[model samples]
Target: MFGGPYPWSLYCGQWSILPPAPKGNYLKDKVVVITGATSGVGLEASKQFADASPEQLIFAVRSVEAGEKLLGQIRKAHPNLQDKVMYLDLTDLQNIKDFSEAIKVFGRVDILINNAGINPNFDEGPYKSTKDGYERVFQTNVLSPFLTTLLLLPLLRKSSDPKVIFTGSDVHHIAPSDLIETALQNGQSIISAYNDEGKYHNPTRYYESKLLLQILSRNLIKTLPDITTINVNPGLAMTNLGRDFNLSLSPSGIVGILWFVANARSASKAARNLTSAAA
Candidate 1:
């Protein structure tokens, strides 16, 4: 049963009916780029795009090995589909720069999907900072994506209709005033703002970061008028993000996870929203 204001029937009634796979090569001859394409909704979106027969599909991933493995699977399924794997570690500013520069070699980029993100579990110790001295969640979910989108603008401009999709979450609806107040009170020091031991909660931090992304998406339209920038909230789906939490270890965790599994949409179904946005 739904626990929030909505009744179970109302929540269940809103479940997305999967849209039919796109017809007739909508992405034909266009280049599609996706970050974090090795797993979860990113991987599902990649599979969905592959079926559309794009001229080239590039994956910007942290692990070339994992990217290669996914590429192989896609190739096995669609032998003629052109694809490549590139390295991109969102936590590192230099990696984002290098990856963006590397992507420029392509004549044009029709679509850029910023789907990579991290939601550190509650059990994952105190808040961590990225190599760039920013909070890990903030850098991974917002800063890096912002930088990458800017760097890729020229390439995106080459296309007749360029689209940038930012993966967002419904959790962003949670008020961020406290987070803003904390950041201001801390003089915007990433460590000081997010490292409060008593206040640290991964899900809360993740929501704050996503809320920042949604704000960015709204402003992007004013700054980059030609490009289509949109933030998409893929409904909750079962994914490896929960690996760190052992549901079997606690009765409550078991029940909670089971309830989620029973109610949440599948990754593939959630991914349709992403692919549909891109198309």
Candidate 2:
């Protein structure tokens, strides 16, 4: 093996000897929901979750079409996993409510992964408001997951050792103020707010989202004693989540090679973390 990345030990071709899947049957018997499931990290996590016989895997995506497409492909690849896609445009309040309602039919949720995000559009990235008028990243990355988690809390409680996992990042260490200001819309720049740009710093949006998420998870952990909450960065995931996520931080090509080299863990690692969270 390679020496591995700077921050995380995870890397390509590395094997995790974490015992066989789990006592549960293929994760299909358990209820697992992953937001942003249409692509990127969410998709990878979903694919891994499919390996276990969980009772249900709910793929929450803003686009019904994309959700359906992902479902088709996942189904074709893993016929045993009967995952259903639902419309959850987190920026839209009603959409979030509807998503919660639709999942009500499932009755219980054993695992929940809050992992959707959006980089601000370059032209007016930072200063833009979502359809619900909240800051885009805050609404999509933070609020959406926050609200979705709330709606599913009851269902989570019904199960034993119900788990909630939030995807975190190292970027949160910088620009904590921008994250708070963006949440309040205190004249945050469109680019800086969306991409985490700064007169001295650049590409803060992804980091800021993670900061808020870390804080949110810490605080929420206090309130829910029964529900276990854990946040993981998963090293450098290869999803379209960061680095050029907004107008800034767009490092040129060879990202796969670099990411694979630098603490770059596959979506399977993140998904594996989720599996541990469930246990």
Per-residue accuracy of model 2 over 18-137 as CA lDDT, tens digit each: 333344454546888888887776776676677676778888887889888888887887787767888788789888888888888988998898877765422333354677766666
- Candidate 1 global lDDT: 0.82
Candidate 2 residue spans exceeding 4 A from truth:
1-28, 121-126, 178-202, 242-263
How many Å off is the CA of 31 in candidate 1?
A: 1.0
Could you tell me which 10 consecutive residues in candidate 1 have the lowest summed lDDT? 1-10
Clashes in each model (backbone N, CA, C under 3 Å)?
Answer: 0, 22
* Winning candidate number (TM-score): 1
Per-candidate Cα lDDT values, in order, are 0.82, 0.68
TM-score (all chains, Cα) for each model: 0.88, 0.75
